[model samples]
Target chain A: MALGGDARVGEVVESSSTGFVSQSYRLYGAPHLGALVRTGGPCPAYGVVHEVATRGIDPSRRPTARGEGEASEEDVYRSNPQLEHLLRTDFRAVIVGHASEGGTLYHLPPSPPPIYAFVHVCVADELSAFSASTDCLRLLAGSGIAALEEVVAAFLRHAVAAQPDPQAFLAGAGRQLAALIPGDFRTVESILLRAAP
Target chain B: MTYRESSGRYLGVVVGGSMTRGVDVRLSPDCPVEEMALGQHVVIQGQSRRFYGVITDIALEWSDDSIRANPPDTSNPLIAGVVATSAAYAMLRVLPMLAIEGEFAMLDGPAPARTVPPHFAPVRLASEEDVQVVFGAEDSRHFWVGNPLDMETRVCLDLEEFVTRSNGVFGKSGTGKSFLTRILLAGILQKSAAVNLVFDMESEYGWMGTSEGTGMVKGIKQLFPSRVGVFSLDEDHSRRRGVSPDYLLRVGYNQIEPGDIDLLRENLGLSEVAADAAYSLARHYGQERWVRSFLDVSGPEMRELAADLNVNERALSTLHNRLSRFRRYDFMTERESDESVEEILRYLDRGIHVVLEFGRHRHDLSAYMLVANLLTRRIHERYVRRKEEAMGDASREPRPLVITIEEAHRFLSREVASQTTFGNIAREMRKYNVTLLVVDQRPSGIDEEVMSQLGTKLVCLLDNERDVDAVTAGTYGARELRSVLSRLDSKQQSLVFGHSVPIPVVLRVRDYGTAESYRELGFLEASEMRRQMERDADDLFGGRD
Candidate 1:
């Protein structure tokens, strides 16, 4: 069962086609070619819904040439059992994206499909999930974006410590890495609030 | 790193690929190395988790317990397999620090490799303080310095080492026994101003010319003159013409008793007795020339006069024969004179170390007797002079002269005791500081008393057990001394025991680097001989033509 639109935990839904399956778990975002692999099934099936309107909404904002070129085939390979284990576990969320500023992607050994990455976001409040996930996703892209958030959050909390601005610090570093590939940001608001200084 | 103390010893953790860091364990001595079975890897220690180190000392260790406990009935696969496995690993590892890790790291880095430290440090047996105390403050007597087995030992000997008394060097031929002997001699010559007289019968020391050419020849020849003195036994006849009749009689004849005079009379002819009576009468008349003047007369006429007196011709002839040398001396002494003889005697009295080089001459007993007689006489005169001076309440400086006789066993016989005057001189000369450096291949052949009196002895590599035992018998420190002598390799090891050197040291002599000099000398002599041969050949052919 799957949901076509965004979701709230309490909402109940049904799949377009189902036979004794669990309640529809709604998950949709930009770059709409997303996937949902049912891990525990006898013959686990991986469904990739390549939405026809995805390219039209964000065609110009594709991943950089380097990101598309140097990416490993493992990024596309999905492991259902591993995904099922993480999804059914106590872990709030798992992110299989760029780990630090240099843009090295981190995939757990039981990887999920490439289209919808695993982003782990453990936030106190669910309302701020979207903003926090976006910031955390950006952080996974580069040192510059992550460092900037650290500075902004530090100021907001009146934790204005004697430290340089992160973006300026990254610029001062001179060298740059290729841009990061995009990932789902459903829990960004909560991630951003939790990661605030 | 975590460490634990076990059996009162600390054991360190095994970090990375290294051995236990803080362990202090060594191989136990109780277990004999020979008993270790093959193919058995004994666990020495476990440093970290899952990291174990083992040592397989032998192959038999890997055999089945039952098979190992019982003797093998036959050559079986079970034993063979274990032996093969054990051979693969037998290295002992202590710690990473002790391992060759540092050397390998240095090799991997950017630099050339060199040497590792030696297991033993070179040191001499004696020290400088010992040297100062034993040899006195006078630096001249430090003969053992630079005389040890190596350069480091030389430095130590030079700075240290002491000798309380004189020393001796003995060895077999070509075993560097002579070379080491020379080293001690050379060292003495360098350190002390004390006089040394070397009797180089083999002509070895004569080559101590200048260290100009190269190799062993690299020495200061200015130590003495190149051509010191040469006494050819072959030329003794011509030499005798210059000595006085009294000296000739002393060497050629021994004193006779009155009983021999009666025997001489009985053997003489009546006519010979008459001739001797007339000659005696002329000598009584103070006509020394007239005694021999009758020899110009006819033999028959002289016999007629002798017949009238009833003198025996042969007995008279013997007296005339005896008087002939006196007449010959009278004629010869008038021209050459005895002043030079007196002068030589005086010069000898002043104590000059003279070399009597009898070059390439086969032994001549007469020449030996003459030279020996002269030397003995001079020495005796000096001894008397010293005795007289002491008795007369006069004081004089002591003269300690050592006479070295190379190949001495040739002249001084062990079987001949003090029979000859020379033999007696050899026996008694020790008291007058007249020490004899008796060198020979056969030390056993020399007079035992002479050998025994020589307080210092240097024994080089001896091929003959008898010779080694004989030389060793007279030495102190017999255990180390005996071992050193028996173990000496030909031309390498030398056993030096004496008052000159402290204890007996087996030394490997350094080459004097005089090979080039010797080669040059050899080459020049060979070319000269060749040229002379060619000239002789040409001369012979031209004369035939």
Candidate 2:
């Protein structure tokens, strides 16, 4: 993909996803992106704004892989000039976490030019944790956009976790999901994917 | 000559007087003198004449009645009681002579004692000149009646004083009290332009106050409003227990004093808590916009409301029903927040005495106190709202209203006494330019504090010794009042006293030719209900067959 380059030492654009996260948290429920990452798959992930880091991985440095995913020597690094292009844009990413015998490890993938069906689990997990408490429920109900966002994030986490995935950590974690958030799983999936990282 | 040795000493007599026929010789030594009784008569020659009539002026020896009683036998023992007992005995006199008579002649010892002569002069009815001395021209205008009016002059039970501040009439039953009251009331209403409000219990004044051929042709309810301003206390008009609903509760009750509260409890058989609760509920209801709807509430419902507020349920309900009935009277419409005195002025000017007549009603203390209180309040409200006559209405043109309560003792009873608002107003209304004309057979039934507040006193002939005593003692000194009340004849005769008249004068009150006298005469041999029936018959038949 053609990436626009700029100063390599510039500060990363801090995404306002936290504002979105709080809004969406009020609007919907907890952030679903975190759960989506921990239980990886082409799951729908949603969060409002966690922090955004735009200084891309140095291309010259050696890459390291941790957790259950196979360690590979792939050149997944991008230059600072390319990072500028992504920094100026929305910070959308597929967050994946691998847990195994050694310990739990986290992986964040490069943002899709247009979001794809990658592991969108990290945002989903965080959204789930925030929506669990009653105070949060009340906050979500009264917080307007924040309430809607909280609800949306919670739904996304539940949706992604419900997906059939052989490698999903929470596979068969509970009873079969009767319905997804917004009362329509397919519609929610399409909307999440359309707005995905 | 045989009378010389008699133990009876020589008593001086009229000598050489022009009226004296002759003088006689005396037997004993000169005797000490004593005063003579006024108007006592002595005889000389054959005719009897008063001592003063016998002698114009002279020094005469006299003795006590005790001495005369034990006169020594000078004539024959059988004639000891005889010999004409000297034909003239000087008697003691306490009072001075008002008029001059003939002259005295010097006579011998043992003059005969004096006797009162019955002068056969024809009795003269009281004349206006006799009343004028006590009642000046301005007040004499209000005086009515004739005959022996002079009797009223001395005691000064001055009723004119009662008329000024206005007076009250009170008494026990059948004292000719009401009859006596009508005489003065009819006089005042006819002769003066002063307005009167008669609370005619038993529909007593309706016949007279009505504007038919009944003579009050200029009465307001006829001339101006033509409404049924007069209300009846008939069962149809008054509320019965459990049968009638309370209007006060419906419209809202005002603040009640503690004495009134006690009366409500005692009279209405309410507990203290209940009375208090009912009172509070009434006050609350008064402030609410939906107050009138409360009238439609059942008695039990009302009682419950009062009970809820801890009011004497019975009292709250009963009183509420009673107040409700008044609203039905044409004169009483729903009061607007802005109803002005200017509106009521028209009615007053129409010469129709607005009788806020609460006759035969079961108001007890609450109704009397409340009504009186409301009137005073209304008057004050008007006075305060008045624009100070624009610096020209200086005559103060006092919104002349006279409140005539027939049985004032009921309202100003010693039972409620100083605790009642009526008592308060009775004392205060004078300053507010309000006059109270209280009428009752028993003035003693009323509190002395209230009775003393009256500026005018129209004393009709009262027969009840206690009633008379109380009224006379309350205002006038007991001595003179006792004399006047004792001698006062009830047949149209009353002593008008107080500031309203120049002096206390008793005269037969002038007849207004109202049906009152007829009612008084015809009221005999009839039950109250029968009397009412007769009145109704008379009204319908117009006195024709």
Candidate 3:
């Protein structure tokens, strides 16, 4: 199937066996945490945004004090024309699987995203199809990343929104989590409550 | 549309944890967890097989982190409402029933092989067919006793097993123990599986009695007039209720055995020496005529007789004084009545149920014990003879007989159980086609051996620990069933578990006084038969006018 809504958001700046780093076009509309993004061709590799960071592209660049005037937030942005290009946003996504012609395969891809590979936001269909199974939630829960539960909850919310029946998807995910951690019902309930619409 | 389809009150999903045989179930939002009672049966449907289980325990888990992250705004009703549903989780611990592979092949036949249903199977309220498969279908051998709590299906008991072994009905006052016993007896009669002889100490089983909510509760004789006969120890008292006894229960002085006197020793307040002296009197005057001839002896004659027998004079005097109480009872006659023990046995052999109503003698412990013991002893001996004869010819099968004795603890207590015929019947009567349906409020007072011999126990609400322990003794799932028994409602609820029921179940005894229940129990047909008999009598006598 031809990819639709393929908005180029970043480029693979760093690569690893498990994950990769991607640099966004600018700070505006940087991918949200847990947003499914893919890179590579023919058989594309998929990853979930785990962390996001923003900084000035030039380390020496610094803001100078300006006198307070009747300038609103919009005027400040317009006056500093270089501010948009000066700063850059970068995000880290843990590579989860790769897409095949038959279907979306869920596992570590054969090869990680190459350096400078263009990262594009996955459309609703692709994201929904990738999240049909909850294996990624298990991976995120055990990832030891900062705010692991919060990240899972965010991914669940995005997945539910991408589905046709949000309530059914949320309930299914709740059941999946319940089965996974049958002893720890509190954690499952917490995730469900956070993910509830 | 989703790939999966689920239906039926979405009870929960099976969950796995540290439990091995038990499964934790996470209830769904639509499931009414509050209404789910313990001991209620549920089914978990798997791909290939269905697992049956009972709800043993329930738990409520609160997600602390979820609550901490989104603290309820109690000031706002909407947010508090949202928090209530979102934060709390309910879990049910289910002990699954063992499913043998070849022993139970779905609906085909008994299959064997221990298999647990797959995990994460959807749990649902057990269907009627499912319940019938587990509890046998209502047929000639299996009869409906009551409905399990929260299910439309009828809970049936195996009448064949029930008649082959002794059983017990235990409850505190007003918990419907009598009603449950009545239902069971009615079931037995409907099946014609056994001839029940009820020693009605309260006269409650022979005549109608009033309950609190239900108006008039018809007794066994009233419900089955054609099949049940009421014999009263005090016919005068029963006559007040317009009930004419089929025959007066007159026990001849010659019929009282030494064991009968021994059983009455406590009620007679006889000292050990006095009881021993009575035996010597029996040896001298013969067991049949001793009590009669002893009553006739004068004070000086008794002193002389005691001296000659080498017995205590004062002890002999006390025994004489206690034995005089029988003179007031017209039914205790020196001459044997035409309605002999053979006649009662004949009726039982003919598939007739007999209720020996005590009437005014209901609270007369001595009278009740003497007559119950003497009559049951004769019947048991006759049964043993018939059983021996039947052994020679299989076609001559001895008819199954069940004698229900109220205040059973008095006869089966540790002090006199060895000597009482009721205890013997509870222990060994099954082999002779005779069983005792023991009813009592204090089961703990009964000997443990007798309690263990009971095949099925219908336990009503009992607050006393010892009574509960006694009723639940030898029950397979006593640990889990104890709580179910103890928590029963004090009126019409009971827990029945034993050889008859596959698993322990709590049931509300069917409405006894309702017309529908009466018709269901065949009382309407009995009443119709009575009316027909009355019309025939009128036609024969009124023609003289």
The per-prediction i-RMS, to one decimal, reads: 31.7, 71.9, 6.4
Per-model lDDT? 0.35, 0.39, 0.78
Query: If candidate 2 were superposed on the true structure by all CA atoms, what would the RMSD be?
Result: 49.0
Report the lDDT tens digits of candidate 2 across residue range B1-545: 12111121224332322112212212112232232211112222223322212111223332223334554334432122212222223332111111112222212212222332232211111233322322333343434333333233322233333444646554345434455555444444544435555555533443434221234412222222232144333434433311121111111232223344444345455555544544465466653322354556774577567656665566666655644554553433344432323334444555455544444443444454445445544554454344244334636545455666655675677866575545655776544445677777778888887777766565665667777777766543344444555555545555554555433444455433444543332222246657787889999988766
Interface root-mean-square deviation of model 3 in angstroms is: 6.4
lDDT of 2 at B287: 39
Candidate 1 docking quality: incorrect, acceptable, medium or high: incorrect
Q: Tell me how candidate 2 scores on lDDT.
A: 0.39
For residue B248, give model 2's deviation from the true position in Å: 18
Q: Runs in model 1 with CA error above 4 Å? A: A1-197, B1-138, B155-168, B177-194, B207-222, B226-351, B362-374, B391-398, B410-412, B420-430, B510-545
| Per-residue lDDT over B155-230 for candidate 3, one digit per residue giving the tens place of the 0 to 100 score | 8898988888999899998888788888888889888878999888887777886676776788888788879888
The TM-scores that each candidate's chain B achieves against the reference are: 0.47, 0.54, 0.87
Per-model TM-score, in order, reads 0.37, 0.42, 0.82
Is 2 or 3 the stronger prediction by TM-score?
A: 3
